[model samples]
Target: MSRIGYARVSTIDQDLETQIVKLKAEGCDIIRSEKVSGASRDGRAELATIIDFLRPGDELVVTRLDRLGRDTRDVLNLIYECEQKAAFVTVLDPHVSTRGEMGHIVLTVLGMVAQMERRFIKERQREGIEQAKRQGVYLGGKARLDHQKVKDMHEGGAGASEIARAVGCSRMQIYRILQSNR
Candidate 1:
């Protein structure tokens, strides 16, 4: 059976190098990676591809259980899918696998813990933001588009496509900006 690896990071700024190296050291024959949140299965094209391409006697490997998914239901669903294909999942950290009955139980518990951890993280983030807002120090994410610049460019005889390229935004954004100003 071939050992296939999967690695993921929640944001683009995070590096997958460490996970990749670990997977490679584990002797994974194939590895698929992506920069996307594991909080949900949506927008996870690499994960979908790996699942779809799984063979009957393969091993799906990940550095951590959370790398597969942080949601318990999603993680369980993924494991179930692998079982259906006669493939097993292997998590390096904590060394869990679905090849045995005990492994299945431990993985389920770990999946639940991971989901709870994600919830706790979100709760703490919300509390921190609220505290910062109370202290008048909270500022949301930085704006990527300048409305005034967009307006000026559009008024200066720039086409939607040209304004979009110049502003480093989409043509649809330019159209919306121009339409809003009209």
Candidate 2:
């Protein structure tokens, strides 16, 4: 049976080295990784590739159940898909495998815990942001495209496509900026 590994992180700023190292150490024949949120199965091309290419008797490995997914239903669905292909799912941490019946129960419990933890993290973040706003210290996210610059360029006869290319942002974002100025 082949050991196929999958690694994921929520954002592009996060590191994937640790997961990759662990997967390599585990002797993964092939490892697919991506920097994308595990909150949804959507837009995760690497993960989709692994699932699509899995062969019967192959083992899909991850460093943790959370790396596979943070949503309980999503995690369960992924496991179900693997099982349907006759492939096994394995999580290194806490060491659960779908090779036996007990593993299914444990994975379900772990998936629920992971989903709960994600909700808790989001709640804490919202509270922190509210506190910052009350203190008048929340300037909000850094502006990717300068509003004044875009406005000036537009007034100077620059078109939406031109401003978007110069500002290194999407044309849709440029259109939004122009609309907000109206």
Candidate 3:
């Protein structure tokens, strides 16, 4: 049976080293990692690959249950998929495994807790943003493209495609900026 490992981080800035190290130490034969949100399985290509490549006797390992996913439904669905493949999932931190009957019950409870914690985090973030707005200190997210530059380029007879390339933005963004100006 092969022991496979999976690691994930929500942001590009976050480190996956700790999880990787732990998984390696746990005797994982192969490891796959990605820098992406665990809130949903949408963009997690590495995780999708691991799931697709799982074999009957393979064991998927993660540092924590939340590392697999923050959504209870998503986590449960992943576990079900693993079960369908006749594979096992092991969470190192809480030391839970799908190799036993009790593990399923405990994992379900932990998954619910993780989802609840994510909701709490988002609620606190919304409250903080609201407070900041009330204090007139919230400037909102930073713009990825310079609107002024885009406007200037368009006004200077630059085509949407040319302006997009020059401004380091998508053609759709250039169109939006031009449309907003009109």
Candidate 4:
């Protein structure tokens, strides 16, 4: 089977040397690299191109699983696509290479860990928001227009369209806030 490497960076200023060194050390035949954010949908051109070029029995290698995607879902999807194409994914860091039965076990365990981390983060955020609300502090964003002033204006016969224009927001926003405070 032929082995290939893919490397990526979020921006042009970021270094690709470390990833390249690792891929080269792993004996990659050809390294496909790019500078793009993992969060960006259009940022993974080099990766997509490399996947398209792979044939059956080809191995796709990356420095780490996180380098392959911004989140667990995207990472697993990419891995699944590789498997569907009869290719393999080998992650250099953490030493997980999913090309065989044993590797599948590792992948499953890692996926569970990733999912748990996501859930923990979400729970923590929920707790933080609840705590902030209990403190009676601003738990959310500040109003674009002052609530009291808006109420007074509306009560003073200011048209909804006029308030919206003065506040630099849509008429729906003014009406919604007014309804809420009432």
Leading candidate by TM-score: 1
Q: Candidate 3's residue-wise lDDT over 18-120, tens digit each?
A: 9999999999999999877899998788999999999998999999999999999999999999999999999998999999999999999999999999999
Candidate 4, residue 127: how far the Cα is off, in Å:
13
User: How high is the CA lDDT of each candidate model?
Assistant: 0.93, 0.93, 0.92, 0.80
**RMSD for each model, in Å, please?**
4.4, 4.6, 4.8, 10.9
For model 3 the local lDDT of residue 103 reads 99
By TM-score, the better pick of 3 and 4 is 3
Better of 1 and 3 by TM-score: 1
Which residue pairs overlap in candidate 2's backbone?
A: none
Instruction: Point out the worst 10-residue segment of candidate 4 by lDDT.
Output: 35-44
lDDT digits (tens) for residues 63-90 of candidate 2: 9999999999999999999999999999
**Per-residue lDDT of candidate 4, residues 41-87 (tens digit):** 46477898887888898999988765776566677778888888899
- Name the weakest run of 10 consecutive residues (lDDT summed) in model 2: 164-173
| Candidate 3 clashes between residue pairs 3 or more apart in a chain or in different chains | none
Give the Å error, residue 116, model 4: 7.0
Better of 2 and 4 by lDDT: 2
Residue 46, model 1, lDDT: 93
List the candidates' TM-scores in order.
0.81, 0.80, 0.80, 0.59
